[model samples]
Target chain A: MSSEVRRIRYSPPWGDASIIGVAGSSGSGKTSLALAIVASLNLPWVVIMSMDSFYKPLNAEQSAIAFRNEYDFDSPEAIDFDILVDRLRDIKQGRVAEIPIYSFEKHNRIEKTTSIYSPHVLILEGIFALHDQRVLDLLDLKIFAEADADLCLSRRLVRDVKERGRDIEGCIKQWFGYVKPNFYKYVSPQREIADVIIPRGIENTVAISMVSGQIQKTLAHKSAQHQEQLQRLGKIAEDAPLSPNAIILPQTNQVKGIHTLLMDPKTSTEEYIFYFDRLVTLLVEKAVDFLPSHPEQVITPAGNVYMGLKTSVGTSAVVILRGGSAFETGLRRTIPDCRTGRILIQTNYRTGEPELHYRALPKNIAEDGLVLLLDPQMSSGGAALMAVRVLVDHGVPEDRIVFVTYLAGPVGVNRVLSVFPEVRVVVARMGDDMEERWVESRYLGC
Target chain B: MTDNTAPSQSVGPEYLPIGRKPTATVSTNLAHDNVTILPQTSQLIALLTMIRDKNTGRADFIFHSNRIIRLLVEEGLNHLPVVEHTITTPVGRTYSGVKFEGKICGVSIMRAGESMEQALRECCRSVRIGKILIQRDEETSKPKLYYDKLPEDIAERWVLLLDPMLATGGSALMAVEVLKSRGVPEDHILFLNLIASPEGAKNFAERFPKVRVVTAFVDMGLDEKNYIVPGLGDFGDRFYTM
Candidate 1:
C-alpha cells in the first residue's frame, strides 16, 4: 500500500516569546479546536485567551446601537486589540494579566474578570487575532480554521439562537449585512499568513489530532525550560530565609502530649474522645487569636463592667459544609452561635478539579467579616488554596482569613503559604514528611 | 497479619477543643489500630461472585453492598479498643468486658455513600451519620462533593466514614478533606468502603499514610469513569434501585 501524505500541523513557539494565534471567521470552531489541542497535549500551562473577552466596553452610543443590532460587531475595531496585545505580551513574559469577561447578551465587557497567570502556551483565538500587525508579530505559529461560508453562517445562526438568545431575523440580518463582508475583508486575508489551515475545523478530527500532537511536542520543549526556571526559583526561595509571614504554631509539651494521645495505640476510645475534644478546643482558641480583632467593651452583671477590647471579628460568618461542617462544635463553643455559610467543594475524578457543588454564603462575605477557613486535613492544599483564592477574588481581604486545619503536611502548608502568605494558618500538628497523592491503594496481600 | 505498631495512647481522659473553650470531655488517644480492619470471608465471596456475574441486577447488587458494609463495619468496630466497665447486676454481682469510650458518628459520602449508612447504624447504637454528596464528573470521572451536612463536633466522636465504592479515590480523598477541614484528626477518621481499586487505594494511602481504609474487596482495575472493574454498575444508581 502506498503511504498517505501527512498534513503539516502548525507548531507552537519553542521559546518564551512565541504566541499561538487561533484565527478563523465566526462559527469556524476555532475555540473548540484549540481546546482539543490544549487537552490532548496535557498542556496545563496553556491559557486559552478568547478575543471575545477583550471586546471593548460599549459606549452609550454603541450600547443603543447594540440594542438595535446596528453596531458593527464583526469589525476589528470592535475588539480592544491593543489590550489583547498587552495581555499576550504579559503572559509570555510570565506575568499575570486580568483577562476581561465578555458578556454575550449585553454585548459588552462584564465587570467581573478572570486572571491568566503565567501560562506558557497562549491560545489567542478571535476573528481579528490575526488581523492586527502587533498581534501577528508576536505569534510564532498562526492557525486558520476554515469552514464553508454557508456552513459558518448556519452554525453561527444556531449558536446565536441557542446561546446568545437572538431571533433568526436579527441573526440573518447581522450575518448577511455585517459579518459576511467583514469576514472577506478582515478574517479571510489572514489565510496567507497561517502556517497551517484546519479544513472543516472541529469536524476534521484527524486535523485536530495532528495539531494536538504538535502541541505536545511544543509543551515538552517548554516544560524543560520551565523546569529549569522553576529550579532556579526554588533555589532562590530556599536561600531566602523563611519569611516571618509563615507563622508556625508553637510545638509545646502539651502539643506533643496531644499528638502522643492521638498516636497512642492503647488509648481507649473514651480517652481518644476526651483528648480530641480538648485538642480541638485549644486549636480553635489559638486560631481565633489569629483573627483580626478590634477593642470593644462588655458590661458585667455588677454595676461596673470590665473595659476590654474585643477582636474585630469581621461581621462575615464562618462557611463550611460537607467536610467543613464538622467544625461547628468548636466554632459554636468558642464563638457561640456564630453565623455560618456553606460551600461544597467536591472532586470530580474525571476532571480532577474541585467543582463547586453548592454555595450558600452570607450576602456580604467579602465585606462584613473575617472568614475562618476550617478543614481537618490538607494534603495537596489545592482545594484550600482555590477556596481562599475564590473568596479573595470575590473581594475578601487576604488578612481577613484565618485558616485552621487539624493536620497539615509540609507540602500542602508550603503550597498554601506560597500562594497566600498574608493569610494566617494554625495547625495542631504538622506532618513535615509527607507526599500527597489522589489515588488510594488497598492491601491485597498476594 | 498486618502492621500492628499501634499509635501511642494517653492513659487518662483529656478533653480539649481547638480554637474554642472546652465544652465536654474529650479522650484523645484513639489509636488508628483501634479500628479492626479484617478480611471478611462472606463479603469477599459475595464481591467476587457479584463482579463475576454478568446478569446481576440492581437488587442483588445492593444486597451484596449492604452485606459487605455490614461485615466491614463489624470488623472496624471490633478493632475499636474499649475500656473495661462494670455495672451492678440484679444479683449484686459485677462483670466487665469492654465499653465504647464516646459517641460514634457515621459520615456517608452521599449517593453510593449513603448505602453504607444502614450498616453503620446497625452496628453502632444512636450513631449520627452525616451526609456528604460528591458527584463524579461525567468527563473526568472524579468525585465532586455537591452537598454536605455534618455533626456539630465530629472531631470529638469516632467517625466511621462510609463510601461504598472507591475507584480513583478522588471522592474518598475529598471526603477526608471535608472531615479534616472540620478538625477531625487524621487518626480520628476511619474510611470504610464496599469495594476499592488498587490505583485508588494506593493513591489515598500515599497521601494520608496514617489514615486506614477498611474495604471488603479490592478490585483489580478501574474503567474510564474510575469505576471498579468487574465492579457492579454505579453503586449510587444501583443502590437507588435506578
Candidate 2:
C-alpha cells in the first residue's frame, strides 16, 4: 500500500521475488540481522516485515494484565496468523498489503496502518516468523538467530528498562516467568525448521555475509531468467501464427460496416458504443451456437409434432473488466438465463503485466455448463491469458472456455493458443494490423 | 420382461478387466425413442476431444469431465416438474416465473458416479445425496450391488442418478432396480451420463420404460467386450488413475 514500494510491473511465469524469514527469541537481534541483510544486499527494493505488527489487539482486561507484566507476549496465540498468511499471499502475488502497527505500551494495535507494496526482497523477522506451517511454506529462506539464554535475558533486561520504561525488577521477573519459558517452549523448537542458523546473531559477521551473498546470487539468477522469459514472450508475439483453434468471423458487408464505424477516428463515443454493442451481440449469438443442445419434440399450435433444438444446459459468462464489460449486454441479449461473473485485471503500469485486482464469480461457476470469457480487444493477450488461467484454476475446463473478443491480433491469439490449445477463441477480426493501434497507444502512454 | 436370472461368475477386484477387447458380440435391443443424445456443439466437441485424447493428464481429464457432467445435469433438470410463480420486477412490472416443484436428490452410482456429485451439489444447494456401489463381476460383467445408502425421504424427492459412462447398461439397470426397491417411482428418476452407447441405452430403456435417459453423446454400438466403440478408454482409470 506504500507508494514508495516499487510496483513490479512484469511477472514471468517462473520467477518471483524472494522471501526470507528471520526467526529468533526476543532480543536475539532478529531485526538487526534483517536490517543488515537488506543494507548489505544493496537492493533498490527491500521490505522488513516485523511479526510484532501482527499482534492481536488486547481487550481491557488483557491490557490491564499486560500493563502489570502478567501477559505472555511470546505465545503463538498472541498473533493474528490469519491476517499474516493473507498478507504473505498478497505480497507473493505482487499486490500491496496494509500491515498493522502494534503499540507495545498500550498492548493493542494502533489505529494507523503501514501500506507496503510488493518488494524485490522481503525479510520477515519475529519470534513466530517460522511458527505457522502456512507461513513457513511461503518463506524462500528461513534463518534462526541463536544466542546463549543468559545473553538473551541480559539483552532483554537492558532494552526493556531503557526503551520500554520498565523497572529492573519487573523486567527480570517477566523475563524469567513469561519470556524465557515461552522462548524455550515455542521459539527454540523452530530452530529445526530453519535452513540456516546464525550463532551470536548480528555479531557473527561471517554468517551474515554468507546469507546476504546467497540472496544476491538468487536475485541475479531470477532476474536473468525473468528477462529471458520476457524475450521469449516478445518473440512469440513477433512470430504470430494463426492458431488452428481460432474462429475468425467472415468479413460480411454487415460486419464490415460495423468495423468501419468502430475504426473511424471521427466517430462519436455514442455511435461507437452503439456499434460496439451490435458487434458484440452478433459475436455472442454466434458463440452460443457452440453450446450443446438437444432435439426436442413439441406439440405445435397446429397439433403436429415439431422437432426443435433446445439448449442442453446452463451457461455462464465472465467478462474481463472495462473492455470485456462491453460484451455483457450482448451476452445477456443472446442468453438471458446465463449467469454472469466479473473479473478485474489491470496492467501494472510499471511491470506491464496484468495483475488480478478483484474477482466475483457466481456461486457454482464450477458447475456451469459453459463459460464465455469476454474481452473486446487483444493486442498482447496478457489480460486474456491471465483471465483464462483464473478460469482453469477454478476447475473450468480449458475446452469449455470460449473466448469471445471483437478484435484479436495474431500475436495475442497465438500466445493464448500456445498455452491452452483446446480453448476456443472466437474473434470478429484477426490480422497483423490489430497491433498497430496498440503499439501507438503504448508509445503515447495512453 | 427379460430373463431375471443372474449370471454365475465371481472375480477378484484386481482381476477385473477394464478396456479389454471384446471376444464375443452381444445383441442390443434399446428403444431409441426413450434416449436423448445432446447435439454436438463446438464447446462440447472440444471438451470431448480433451477427454478422449489418450495423452490427456488425469487432472485435465477430471476437469473436462466435470464440465461435461455439469452440462448433462443441466439438461436433465429441464425434465423436472415446475410450477409458475409471479414476482414484481425492479421496474414495477409483474413477471411470471417458474420454479421447480419437488425436492431433488442426487443418487450417485459409485465410484465413477462420484465424479458428478460436485456438479449436482452446485446446481441445487438443498438437494439430498445418496450412494450405491455396484461393481461388475470380472467373469460375467454383471453388476452386483454391494452397498446402498439412500436418504430417508428419497421416495418423495425427484432423484437424479449420476453415472459417467453407460457401456453395457448392466450397472444402470441395477441402479434403477435399487431405487425402485426403495419406493422411488420409475417416473421420478432421471439417469444422467456423460456418454452412452446405443445398445446400452436400449437395454436401460427396455428395463425401465418410465425412467428418463440424458447423456452428452450416444456413441456407436458396444463391442464384443461391451465397451462402447470410440469410447474414451476406462473412465475410472483415467479420472482416478486407478
Best of the candidates, DockQ: 2
* Per-candidate total of colliding backbone pairs: 84, 7
Native contact fraction, candidates in order = 0.00, 0.03
By lDDT, who's the top model here? Answer: 2
lDDT of 1 at B36: 34
Tens-digit per-residue lDDT, A1-446, candidate 1? 00121211111122264578989999998888888777767644566888988889897888888877778899998988889888787667544467889887887778787876535567888888789999888897899999888888888998989998888998888988899999988889999999998988777889878877776677666645533433343343444444344445555444444455454445555555445554555566555544433322233211222222233344344454455554666565445656677766654476334434455556567775467777655655556665665566456787677777766666566555555666666777655323332101100101
Error of 2 at A352 (Å): 4.2
lDDT of 2 by residue, B1-242 (tens): 12222111111111123222111111122356666665444445546655765666887677768767866775677678766545542223343444457888999998889889876764454578899999888888677999999999999989999998898888889999999988999999999988777767878878888899988876555556676655677887787763
Worst 10 residues of 1 chain A by lDDT: A437-446
Cα displacement (angstroms), candidate 2, residue A433, comes to 6.2
**lDDT score of model 2?**
0.72
* Global Cα lDDT for candidate 1: 0.62
Worst 10 contiguous positions by lDDT, candidate 2 chain A:
A436-445
Could you tell me how far off, in angstroms, the CA of residue A124 lies in candidate 1 after the best superposition?
Answer: 4.4
